[model samples]
Target chain A: MAAKVDHAQFRLVIPSQTRYLNLVTGLAKRASLVAGLDDATAAKVSIAVDEAVTNVILHAYRGEGEHSVELELRFTEQALEIHIWHTGQGIRSDQLVLPDPKEYIKHPRKGGLGLLLMSRFMDEVQFKADEVSGRNECCLIKKIS
Target chain B: MADLSIAVRHIGDVAVILPAGFINAHTVREFEEALEGQVQQGRYKILLNCKDLNYISSAGLGAIMGLIETVRENDGDILLSNLQENVFAIFDTLGFTQLYRVFPEEDQALAAVAPERKA
Candidate 1:
């Protein structure tokens, strides 16, 4: 007999609001559980999702016209993948550099930590900007060992 | 999202605030306002009881730092007590443990902010 393998996926479409951070965090938690990740890994995933969604709500939208963010979570036996999409103005990947928290600690700067946290916590982080479709997509992948 | 519930009490010369909830960006403003309100009133000897605070993000920690600066600028200090392990990790990661004095119990925190100790 062969060991059974299963895959699970979940999606959510939420308005670009700070309150939606909880929704994304909850979804990531569930995906981590489905992927059988450890408690620390699950908490890191949730934090990464929170940071990503917060970037969309805070920087992407710029507190202007309303927009919607779509989150997709896919879990397999080997890995967990998160896809976040927003219809706001896209950001340049080059400008998305991760700041060293230590440097900020010495100087005490405001902002710019969210992206850094996401990049640090996620195993792989990718950004795609499609100006034609007005879509900014961020993908995060974490391997389950 | 953690709902922040703040209770402010004057313990002799020190003002002790108990903050209960998740210390995330969504819930940080209330915490900020509570501290700022006290600072503006010239009540700077402050202690925060964080036993009920389950988690804290960088933003939430930043808010605390901002309040620390505000209070210190006015010749006041802020002490934190009963930090959950998760929240303590955040403070440690940011090197805040070096910047602020933290106590394990509420009484110690309150004592740290006593009027006689004000600088």
Candidate 2:
């Protein structure tokens, strides 16, 4: 029997605070590299993961004290999938609108860029809400060929 | 959380901000304050040297967007230089290159805005 080196999974659970964002991104980058993504793609994956977790901290768990965000990285032969799970407000991907950077800078509002960056860097983004368990999950998938 | 330190140096009328470390949701406040401090002191001409900056998330980008309007309103602009390839890709993907001037070297960025300093 041979060890299945081509497929793996990693999970981390951290406090729902801004301070832990770097840790999540660090693991995302290293895991991406292990999944055979190029350096640039690894960086992009890290950015996408950062955005997703940031949204979870800011929007999902806003004003809620002492919660935890669960992040799982799944590396398959075809793609790298990152799933972020939290118990808070659910997010709808269809509702997101990407701002035009040229015009957006003139008005200068915070937020609305994270989703755009996530969607741009990741090949597929899926959102799921479990009304029964009251949990919301945002999964980011990056295809590796 | 990764540590971020900011040092500012004045070159004529421009204030050059050197940020070393990661700029994510956790560290964006320090970066924002470093930029905001210059504006409060009436130094609107800003230059961000990202030579030592390792990474930035949307939070950091928002901080830049938050301040650009005020800086430009006062007849000054926030310029960037020495971006790592990964950092530049993020800016380019979001079309920041269209709005902000990015130079390969600090001297080039400083020279590009020297005309404004003269006025």
* TM-scores, all models, native as reference: 0.84, 0.92
Query: Candidate 2 lDDT, tens digit per residue, A70-106?
Result: 9988889899999999998887777657777667756
Task: Using lDDT, give the best candidate's number.
Answer: 2
Top candidate (TM-score): 2
Place model 2 in a CAPRI quality band: medium
- The TM-score of the first chain in every model comes to 0.86, 0.88
- lDDT for A29 in candidate 1 is 75
Error of 1 at B39 (Å): 0.6
- What would the per-residue lDDT of candidate 1 be over residues B1-119, giving only the tens digit for each residue? 34668899997767888888665667778878888888878898888888887666667766767776667777778888998765676566556777778999987776566735534
Least accurate stretch of 10 residues (summed lDDT) in model 1 chain B? B110-119
Query: Which pairs in model 1 have colliding backbones?
Result: none
Off by over 4 Å in 1: A1-7, B115-119
lDDT of 1 by residue, A1-145 (tens): 9776576677889888776666668678767877888766777788778778777777778754378889988887778999999987677677677766677767765666667766666788888988788788989889998
TM-score of chain B of 1: 0.87
Q: What are the per-model DockQ values? A: 0.43, 0.69
lDDT of 2 at A119: 84
